[model samples]
Target: MKQEPSYIEALLPILTLVGLLTMNVFFFEDTLAGSNQVALLLAATIAGIIVRRNGQAWARTMENVVSTIGSAMPAMLILLLIGSLAGTWLLSGIVPALIYYGLDIINPRVFLITAVVVSAIVSLATGSSWSTIATIGVALLGIGKAIGINEAIVAGAIISGAYFGDKISPLSDTTNLAPAMAGTDLFTHIRYMLYTTTPSFIITLLIFLVIGLSYNFSEAVVDVANVKSAIDGAFNTSPWLFLVPLILFVIIIKKVPPIPSLMIGTLLGGVCAVLFQPHMVSEIAGNVPNYAEASYIGFMQAMFGDIIIVTPDADVNELLHTSGMAGMLDTIWLILSAMVFGGIMESGGLLTRLTQPIINWADSTGSLVASTVVTCIFFNTTASDQYISIVVPGRMFRKSYQDKRLKPEVLSRTLEDSGTMTSVLIPWNTCGATQSRVLGVGTFDYLPYAFFNLISPLMSILFAYLNLKIRRYELDEIPVEERIN
Candidate 1:
């Protein structure tokens, strides 16, 4: 007895969510603290009411909501593990060592471009932007800050490179997921994506390079020496500290699942902290009688609570603190709230109703690809999950491509071009929320500077309109009369 809701009924919840989120920007300095979560919940309530009125049972809606949230559990768990890893990495002198060494080697004039390239290499190797950002990206941001670069711009560069690698790397989940959804193989999708991705990346690098070369680094040189001094005085910055990250990278490359890999990395970091930097650990333990007890307390504190390593230089002190597993709680809350809103809207068929018009409007090759890109972005915004954005749009557009004689790789590449690239730009989406928390930069703060991400979808759309690099089915496959074009 379910009936389809009208466009107005379907769009009401989305409009409400958008208006609430916009208001949060003006009213709250830190929207993620609680205001955004309230907005999502309020939107969900409105969607739930409309769904019930449209004859969808509340029981069924609740079931869908649970299932949707369950899908996000792994990401939430990874966020917590990343928090522990950040804390332990700091205590072990790994992150500090990276910054301390990076200061001497990386010139401020090229730091932004270097951050991009380094982050891209790491992400391509791991095939996981989340891990890359949490690990090397954290160090790069610190290096940039120490050298007087803007933290938001540095974060944007790191994210741009990380996502560039994630989009084309064969090991990436989204890279594999896109082709699977579009009836194509992995390598074919990657090969086709490079047609658009390469141009976007080159432009991104050039922008970063120009920005990097424009910086006034005369003052940063003084700060770098002082920062290095503060770090040298605090913990042992041995070259051996790098072994932890190398091992973690090995585990990731071996295709060990993210959870176990991050867990092993976290434990390894704790052990390194105890062995290499007992003084810092002992201080964190606070008045404990023996080295053993101090190690135990310090290790526990670094995994589960906040740890601050103060230094003579106040700026270094700010850079040297970690919030452990507790820091990821707010992000987890935001993810859950977003899932609630997405679930209710999807379970009631409201999302489909909203997208149907765009799908119907596609009359040409350019319009078809453009529609797919818009749908993917729309899903990222409304569903607040990257996987959903790719999966739903891929399903919706597969038949349309077939009817138009477009090869499956065209659809698959477009999926990654837009779906995978833009997810981190939206504040409520899981990628955006997690990266923002990890990097300590707001989504909007870095949106304008995430050049690669901003340019990718446009590149895809441009290629479509220009009929560049677009593959098609064999001409002979069509009937003689149907091929009359």
Candidate 2:
């Protein structure tokens, strides 16, 4: 049997990691580019080297790294598909149509609330916060800016809504990941999550409502009409633009696996672009005469290449570009770096070592949830990736949750609240990096406005203290083999 790691040994690696990554964040804002990932790999290597020095086989340590990353491969794959889906979906006019329609429906008087609600609806439909933000979120932010809303407030509303859908949707990896790690089924976990999630959702909507009611609707209408006309003139904007998104959502509802579903959605989008927006594709390919050839070449390149759309206006120029697969490289690099740190931690037994004190002292359920919340924040600070934030703390805290007679869903839910939602609040984390890339907003600039995230940790802690909807553990609720596993 393998021995567990000591607290001091586990903690030193994390402390070193946190100190270095914090400095990296300060020096690099959004520019550290994979330096945070490098920091993680170095920290994990240090942990692995320690175990080897103590006579643990280096091969065994390496194997643990493999297993740790192997488990997360599913999530990594999902992210890739999501990136591709965004590109092709944009090509098909699904996203543009959503933007045009969203701009139409969301009046300025209710812009903040509408922003949150619309982001939630689209992210749920597509199962992607990143996509939702990059497309419609960008459009809304621009619209909100034109309407005189606080940029931070608009960014926050966008993130809040986007994440709400991402958290609750059956398609979200974090939703699936939480359950996978906590010994629960995906649907079971999601259903259980509704308890806490619904309350948080309601509270968030109410807060946005108050903010939205304060905006001037008439001024927004004039600004919005200009944007709508501009988008319509740019592409053949029609009600048909919505069919692609609806089809994508339907495939998800039919229980199509996210990878194939997104792939199908992307292809469908490209086809839709050819049929509905031939002029747009032909213009993009610089071949106004050969529309069919232009559309095919343009769509295929768009699936695999960097394509920028230039409008007569500068702001529209920023809005009209897609890197397709190239845009996802930085995120993939960050995920890989995060996995190395996780692999080392698992191999060294450092994760277990780190969780011991918190587990040993967690006599109350409230403390247990609080501990998990703290651990998540620690990983984002130290490990510098949301993947590690979810994975490491999840593995460390699972047994503690069971031993305390609390259901695994509690752990999963708390992990999402603290891990997934708060990740963008930290500038070095992957979620932060991606959001900053997508929205053109600084992490520090929007941190205060991400009210749902800012409040979720406290809300989770409070639930723990009040014992609200915290499910009790039941041994008979699981199978014997599962118990042994």
lDDT of 1 by residue, 327-380 (tens): 767767877786788778888888778767876788888999999998889878
Model 2 CA deviation exceeding 4 Å by range: 1-4, 29-32, 118-159, 162-195, 211-218, 283-295, 363-366, 379-388, 398-412, 423-449, 458-485
- Model 1 ranges with Cα > 4 A deviation: 108-203, 206-220, 361-450, 459-485
216-314 in candidate 2: lDDT tens per residue? 754545544655666677777788777777786677667666668768877887888888877778866777577777987878767766666554444
Error of 2 at 156 (Å): 4.9
lDDT of each: 0.81, 0.74
> Which residue pairs does candidate 2 place in steric collision?
405-473
Candidate 2 yields a Cα-based lDDT of 0.74
Q: On a 0 to 100 scale, what is the lDDT of residue 427 in model 1?
A: 90
TM-score of each: 0.69, 0.79
